[model samples]
Target: MCSHYDPVLNAQKLKQHFGVDDLPPGLKPSLWPTYVGPFLRKHEHADVGDEAVPFKELMVGSFGLIPHWAKDTKIARQTYNARSETVHEKPAFRDSWRLNRHCIIPAEAIFEPDWRSGKGVATRIVRTDGKPMGIAGIWTGWKNPANGEILRSFSMLTVNADDHSFMRNFHKPDDEKRMVVILHEDEYDGWLNSTAEDARHYLRQYPADGMRVAVHD
Candidate 1:
């Protein structure tokens, strides 16, 4: 249930922290790349939540999910995050996992772990370098049965943490599971256009110590 994450840096902050050349002009300014909040498409004519019309490159999606079917407007309250392992198999997520899976979940940091003797001690892991961490994810569309409206949303992908990784010790010996899949710089394109096989191929785990962690400041 990795329902919460943060983009310590986003389009607005991209130019300030990262080299302007790294990103095409499209991914900046429109959306913050999260589950909720913000009018990402600054363009006047763009549709608010439909996927049929492609949005400007400058404004990324406010959410990565394009819901296949949404019974109520409130389904979003619980669908912010979907587990990578199960997503490919679930009815709600399978379509997005195979075809509609195009997204880059940018973040400055993520929360993972270290294990105490019996309990889990949480830590905030930030990138070792100043550059932002862009985790892998999937998106889909939901059509509201009641109103006949469409909404796009997303979920972050997660892989198990290894024994020596930062959150490795969090679980019992048989189960040191972790959230937050870390993508390699070269692996970006593969993930954004990932096919079902690609889902099993490219999404690699981030290094255990690849990020910095601290108590909330």
Candidate 2:
């Protein structure tokens, strides 16, 4: 599960990357499950057109997913990641997927536990080209019944990485290997708008050769 990442870009950079006109002010430089960060979702009322695709303004949402049917926020910690094979069938994520509530979580770098040296060590992974990655995700809105406050949250999608040359080096030796679904820049729009059948094509491991990793003390 990817629980942390470097959200190093500011609102201006995010707006430019997603081609949006507005974003929330004062975004943080890093984010964890409970932190608020920017995500791009399709506009709710975009009209059918051939000239241009309508994009919704950038939205600030929490990283952990809190399904609308969830009774409380405690479930979010366990819902941070949804496996690709089950995302369409899981109770917590199926509704969002069915409704086409998809999103993109941009990250400058992501942290993982690298066990290559025979001991678990923290490692930061980033693109070899030094550009941010658009991780595929799903989002939904939840309301606190007590205060009637609505909160939107998301979960990163992951796929099996037991055979991945690079990603297989992380996590515990005995644990099941997994990696987040990092989408190519060109697939951003398609991921946010593609039907479930077509979206399956986007859920695969990014090439290991395109990434670099640094072990931390």
Candidate 3:
């Protein structure tokens, strides 16, 4: 599961690569659980049949999902990544999953720990083509009752990666290996608009050959 990553911070790259027209303020260069970052979701006006409005809209949200019933935002630390197989059953993620609140996390790279060397070594993973990765996710809004402040948050969707030649190398030897779902460029719109049933088709693992990993110093 991804807990640390580099978000696409360049305005030009956000626009050219993700088709996001504007960059919202307060996005960080690096993100961890509870950190605010950029994500893409279907524009609200898209269903209105307006051809002039873009299909996707850029949003800034917490990296970890905060359920509506939560008392505070601290729960975000434990809800950063939702397992694809159990997302529908998990209380924190089920509502968003059922509602088809799909989102795309725009990331420059994801950081994981490599344990092959007998010690945890930080590694940076990115696409071989040097393009941004559009990771699959689900989003929702949580309101703080005390102040009535609305906070938007999301969680990355992960799949088992024990059989993946590349992804299986990360994490601990005894732990179940996992990897985030990286969607292909062409599937962005399909994923954003897909129904709960169709969203499963986009949760598969990304091909290992298309990715490059290096030791992070």
Instruction: Give the lDDT ranking, best first.
Output: 3, 2, 1
Q: Which structure among the candidates has the greatest TM-score? A: 3
Regions of candidate 3 where Cα sits further than 4 Å from its true position: 215-217
Best by lDDT: 3
Cα deviation of 46 in candidate 2 (Å)? 2.0
* Clash total of candidate 1: 16
* lDDT per residue as tens, model 3, 12-97: 99888889868877777999999999899999788988799899999888999999999999999999999999999999999999
Question: What TM-score does structure 2 among the candidates reach?
Answer: 0.91
Alpha-carbon TM-score of each model against the true structure: 0.67, 0.91, 0.97
Q: How accurate is candidate 1 locally (lDDT)?
A: 0.55
lDDT (Cα, tens digit) per residue for candidate 1, span 1-217: 3544565334456444322212433333223234452212112333477675433222234343545664554555555556666877877678877674555566665654455666565556677775676666766656667677656566677776665456665555566466667677666555654567756775556776776665553
What are the lDDT figures for the candidates, one per model?
0.55, 0.83, 0.93
lDDT of 1 at 178: 64
Model 1 earns a TM-score of 0.67
Task: Report the C-alpha displacement of residue 125, candidate 3, in angstroms.
Answer: 0.6
Q: What's the number of clashes in each of the models?
A: 16, 0, 0
